[model samples]
Target: MNPSRRGLILGAGAASLAGPTLAQTDGLVLNGRFVQGGFAMGRAAPRAIVFVNGEALTTASAAGLFVVGFDRDAPPYVDIEVHAGNSVGGRVARRTLTVAPGSFPSTRINGLPQSTVEPSDPALLARIQQEIALKTEGFASRADADDFRSGFAWPLDAYRVTSRWGSQRVLNGTPARPHYGIDLAAPAGSPIRAPADGIVTFARPGMHFEGGLTLIDHGQGLITAYLHQSRIEVLPTQRVARGTIIGRVGATGRATGPHLCWRMKWRDRNCDPSLLIGQNAPENS
Candidate 1:
């Protein structure tokens, strides 16, 4: 059989078969947890085949365990398929996963008074829409996983972490969106840096929702956003090396205090920023 056709057939069968039963066949058993934009798998058969929502992922070695992430957000339930083939025979297995929404952290503002202003003021809403468009247009590219793995850097100087990625949040006794990025608490004038080498795409001050925002486009459809800044030091279309100072943290636009809300996106998929930073990693440019 042609390798591509064989792969498809194996994938289809794997999608319907149980891991253990497939193991009894010529294929290896595969198990994993699936979530929006990310997955974790273990004890896969050596040289096993893997597919997520019908998309094939590159496996680097014959190790039975692997992980995969996507550049798009997936709904709650996702399908996973796997197959393992050797000279003698192969097996296929399929499973379903229910992904939970990521949690965001709560940040307490020390000196701001409670505001009575309506959050839905027409002028504010329009400006927010414009900003979202700019951000969306800036990140609308598709790149494979290899493009992101080249190297990762901290976008800003390491400071005391005010909030962590994926922490649950409650605003004023009401549940709000989960915190998507790691927050670094620094002085209002503390300089903010880029996490990786990329081109500046969007740099604007006080549009509507975001007070001072800067966005960078890393090649292959990856982008980072810096929001609620007190100052923007870079201009749109400027090329920045990793760790370059682009702005300073501040309480701008709907914020209660001075802090930086650094966010990362792979196309439309929001991802955790902490995963890309490691100890003693070079502060690239």
Candidate 2:
């Protein structure tokens, strides 16, 4: 792939950081936030092959659109390469991107039960492990559609942000894993809508940590999860349109109060769903 043929397309929002060096190439273009925990949308020739840092992505669509995600702890640089046409004699395009590191703050949360912080019951731990395995299968979904092309909207019509993503969480005086979801504080029974078109991959109630959880696959391994719901209206394998009500918020699970833990994953990378709100990938030029 030639380095001179790569391009990036950025929209008009905070998600569109100004760092990508767009080239004069015409066939392949990518657009999105060039920061850690952000995602990018791209378009290439139909059936084109895309590789990020030498790993093959889940193949391009018939329309040539694709999406790439930067992990929360992603390195400062990324390399994107596209191969159009057949491998024997195809046009190659490449771009070395600069990814900005995220600035995460420490979040202290107290007044939690001791068992939740440090579980000692063997049976409870085993159940937690089983739940983790089920969630893993949900995150591994990679439907071959660019459903994200419709862009994203806020899941809740009215809510207050209680916790932002990528915060170092300290629960009850003990440091824990970094929080990866944006906590939306809303009244119990407040409806949560689908941010984009997707297929429901997992929906279950009464998990240990997450009392109620619903995961939606927004195509190409980009999945969004809703946690601590009071009522789940959808089921696994169901197709939901954007703005459809999937569930209602609640204070179930380990939460301190009524809220919705909104999380997103693009393949193995955890990205900030807030960045994609009101942002759509630029159309092919």
- In order of listing, the candidates' clash counts read 16, 2
Candidate 1 local lDDT, 1-285, one digit each (tens) = 211111111244332211212232433333222334333333356556566677654331344443344322457656656666622245665555544443344654333323312356677567667777886776664322222333456655656777876565555554556666667777788888887777887898885546898887655445678888999999988888777899998888656667788777754567665554431211111
Evaluate model 1: give its lDDT.
0.56
- The best candidate by TM-score is 2
lDDT for 203 in candidate 2 is 98
Q: What are the lDDT figures for the candidates, one per model?
A: 0.56, 0.83
lDDT of 2 at 128: 91
Residue 133: error of model 2 in Å?
Answer: 1.1
RMSD of 1: 10.6
How far residue 149's Cα lies from its native spot in candidate 2, in Å, is 0.9
Considering only N, C-alpha and C atoms within 3 Å, which residue pairs clash in candidate 2?
9-30, 9-31
Please report how far candidate 1 places residue 38 from its true position, in Å: 6.0
